[model samples]
Target: MDRITKLTSEKPVIIFSKSSCCMCHTIKTLFNGFGVNPNVHELDEIPGGREVEQALLRIGCNPSVPAVFIGGELVGGANEVMSLHLSRSLIPMLKKAGALWV
Candidate 1:
């Protein structure tokens, strides 16, 4: 869970993911397209990915890939992330967190 600590208080956006999710890849591509430096924590790389397991316990979400958080607020799965991006809310949120300019 040390990596979890690194994630906490470190970035405005954090994406918890697995390698196989198309939505996860899309979200990463979306962030890149926006020039946002979203911190990605691949669950596969974490110890047992137990951190994701714990997050599921806390959030009550069933271990879905691409668990995204913004300013430490759990923003939910990929569709929600894409919705935010589509509505242009993601950029404002990033700006609020100093993760983006304007």
Candidate 2:
């Protein structure tokens, strides 16, 4: 498995994102609201972040920043996250993944 795969599997929630992206921040904030300290990989700040992004794309991810993963599964991007939240699925997912205690 690649670094991304390994990390995603290790963390209950993980976000591969860019620091400057508003959607990224939004997703991060949403997780925080749920009291989840998601493992965040800031793409723009790392030397080979672009490559990792490309790798994620090739693996059929959102091909953009704020790629959220739960239990090693791609949970899509910002809009997906918001939709899940609105539908009350996000919390269940978090709980199933052991990311949310309450």
Measured by TM-score, how close is model 2 to the native structure? Answer: 0.93
- Clashing pairs counted in every model: 0, 0
Instruction: Assess candidate 1 and give its TM-score to the true structure.
Output: 0.81
> How many Å off is the CA of 39 in candidate 2?
0.4
lDDT against the true structure, per candidate, is 0.76, 0.89
lDDT, candidate 2, 1-98, per-residue tens = 29788879989999999989998998999899889999999989988898889988877666577899998899988888899999999999999999
Best by lDDT: 2
* Candidate 1 lDDT tens digits, 36-80: 888888777777686655755566545567777778777878888
Backbone-clash count (model 2): 0
Give residue 32's lDDT in candidate 2 (0 to 100): 94
CA deviation > 4 Å runs, candidate 1: 1-6
On the 0 to 100 scale, the lDDT of residue 74 in model 1 is 74
Clashing pairs in 2: none
Off by over 4 Å in 2: none
